[model samples]
Target chain A: MLAKIHITLKKDVLDPQGKVIANSLSNLGFEGIQSVRQGKYIEIMLDGNDKNTATNKLNEMCEKLLANLVIEDYSVEID
Target chain B: MLAKIHITLKKDVLDPQGKVIANSLSNLGFEGIQSVRQGKYIEIMLDGNDKNTATNKLNEMCEKLLANLVIEDYSVEID
Candidate 1:
């Protein structure tokens, strides 16, 4: 099975890197760009017998390493 | 308008960070994790009259700032 994890910063958090990119785009004349938020997508291949097992494993992965839960939020989809 | 940009490392690229995460997940007893590939998602808010103009602007953003085309591949979806 394969699981796709998406991790993103919380809405209120300041995304300095994304801000820099947005400014650079504006400077390059790509007008009307108002904002940017950068996030992470991770694809993990796993072996699980069922969705419950996969969900449990993925939750552990997200909490321990896949994301920094303090400043980021994550969601996972398994196939 | 909002454009979502996804940037990912090329297939042959070595993702040490993702490997580390994968290993850590295995260590945490999340069984059967065989591999992990990481990527980036960027949301850009722009003002454009139509898809063509938005696409043109987004392409410029990707080339000049949104992504490092040398090591990454990118795609964009607008809404």
Candidate 2:
């Protein structure tokens, strides 16, 4: 199974790196870019065929190491 | 318009950060993990309603500043 995970900052959390990207884009003459928010995308290949098991393991991985629970949220997709 | 971009390293490029994550996951007892690859996900809010225009601008953005064309590949989706 392959698990795709997206770990993103919560709505209330500030993202300085994203802010810098937005500013840089504006300076580059790309107009009307209101905001930019960045996150982490991870793809994990697992040796299992069961989707359920992979999902459970992925969730556990997120909670344990992939995501900072207090400031970020994660979503997982199994294939 | 909202543009979602995924910037990933090419298959040939070595990703040290991902290797570290895989090692950490193994140390944490997650088994049967074949590999872990990490990328960047970015969302941009634009003031235009036209998807075509947004897509064009996004491609330009990616080429000009968003991605390092030498070692990375980028995909842009407009919604």
List each model's interface RMSD: 1.4, 0.7
* Cα shift from native, residue A36, model 1 (Å): 0.6
Which pairs clash in model 1? none
Tell me how far candidate 2 lies from the true structure as C-alpha RMSD in angstroms: 0.8
Tell me what fraction of the real C-alpha contacts between chains A and B each candidate also makes.
0.93, 0.97
Poorest stretch of ten by lDDT in candidate 1 chain B: B24-33
Residues B1-79 of candidate 2 have per-residue lDDT tens digits of: 8889999999999989999999999999999999899999999999978898889999999999999999999999987
Give me the candidate number with maximum lDDT. 2
- Stretches > 4 Å off in candidate 2: none
Docking class of 2: high
Model 1 spans with C-alpha error above 4 angstroms: none
TM-score of chain A of each: 0.90, 0.96
Error of 1 at A54 (Å): 1.6
* Reference-based lDDT, each prediction: 0.84, 0.94
Candidate 2, residue B1: how far the Cα is off, in Å: 1.9
In terms of docking quality, model 1 is: medium
